[model samples]
Target chain A: MLRKMRRRITIRIDMTPMVDVIILLLIFFFMTSTFREAEAIDVQLPHAYAGVRIPKTGVYHILISEDGKIYADNEPMQSREEFIQAIVSSRATNPNLIFDVKADQDVEYGVMLTVMEDLRRAGIVRFNLSIFKEAGAW
Target chain B: MAGANVGGGEGRSRTGRRRISIHIDMTPMVDVIILLLIFFFMTSQFKEPHGIEITLPKTDVPVKIPESNTVTLRVDENNEVYFNEEPVEEISKIREYLIARQTENPNLVTILDVHPSAKYKTMVDVLDEFKIAADETGVTKFSLAMKREETAPEGGGG
Candidate 1:
């Protein structure tokens, strides 16, 4: 008489390929993407007849929304403390980064004043707000 | 949560004679990920910095500013923003603004002016505000007009 034999189970996967692919993708994005030195929020910038394109340089872009919300490179900060830390980090990497601010047309004047004050306190030397052409146009 | 359950299956498994370990030490990985998340969360920059509302003006003439170098400020129809001609922000942004100005070396300074049909007082503020940024940065050479007709000088527009 012969005894019955049981089937064996074997499952092995090489995770190296997947991890390698993920790391490769990360590297690709790191090299080909534009890392915003500054945070920019949702604010419809007035379209210019000629919104000229400048060369690639250390420039910071700031966006202010209609509700007067501020963003740095898409990251939202609640207070000056958060803003300062973000600026300090950007300055560390790109000291020459120029602060380019874009605010909604309907934003309050006093609110802008406070934002400027905060940038000054944080040590941003240069910056400008963007505007579109005349009314009834883009 | 989904991944935790999948990885947890091997966590409590008893070791065989050979003791083949298949667990991914998620504790350390999770710690590292959390730390990185915190670092980025703490370091990210905010654009608004502060909540300020100012209506911007629309200019029939669109200015060409390159992606880099220039700092643009807008003035809306509301005269609340420094009488509508100046920038709402202070002098800090001026240095960079002027630096961009000099770098571009444009025949004219591209100042965008948008004026909506708001109240007269608001319009005045929008037009007259935010000059300090330019003044502080020492960028005086500029132009003040909408657009030189598409017809252009001697018909540049085709």
Candidate 2:
């Protein structure tokens, strides 16, 4: 009993497994993660169940606020002419740029369509409309 | 293990030959790695962006569809949905109407004509329902009609 009392119990935990897992996760995130640019305007995107995953790279954002304000790639435009000019300049640098439009749900359909008409006039045939995912049966 | 022993003289083996045990202090490295991991986890957008693909016509010319073969849906400013000039009680009924109409006429084309003052969400909701109906009937022909005269910008001025 004296010998048993003299010996002290020591507790040790091996952190190798945890460190290994963390390193693996770090590498995974490093490979797959892409940083998103800060948005100039806030928009409450509409929810739809038919939304498909859009490509993250080579995307130019077109944001439309609730008050009919338009932002091209976080740059506020004074008018539709300025918006078109911005698109034209951006297209010069990146020919493969795909516009991804994010309009607030409260925005008027007229404003949105007028923007689309301008895009059409600018020779842009295809674009993506950003939306949130709604929970539903796929 | 705390520090690395680079040819330390204090370590000696039983054979009288000099020996050393090298160890690396992993605490600092681990701390940095953990910090990076947390930063990435917080900054990355967890949800992938979802969107709908749209293709517009190249010219200002409009394509005409037969009146009898077309079903025009009108959504007013108050979120009121009208099906072929008839008011619909609920938006959900659109799916049923489309499915029934498509079954009746295989060549039927849908046209969405939303009022300028209508909310954008109403159009999206209607499009979603149209997609559902299209999925059921395997027909995807649809058109978006908008008024361009009153709001048209004639001058160079914005």
The best candidate by lDDT is 2
Query: DockQ (Cα-based) per candidate?
Result: 0.03, 0.69
Model 1 Cα displacement at A50 (Å)? 11
Q: Tens-digit lDDT track for model 2 on B1-113?
A: 32334355445323454466655667787899999999898887767898877776665555655688888888988889999989999888899999999989988878887
Runs in model 2 deviating more than 4 A are A1-10, A135-138, B1-25, B148-158
* lDDT of all predictions: 0.46, 0.81
TM-score of chain A of each: 0.58, 0.81
TM-score of every prediction relative to native: 0.35, 0.82
A70 in model 2: Cα distance from truth in Å? Answer: 0.6
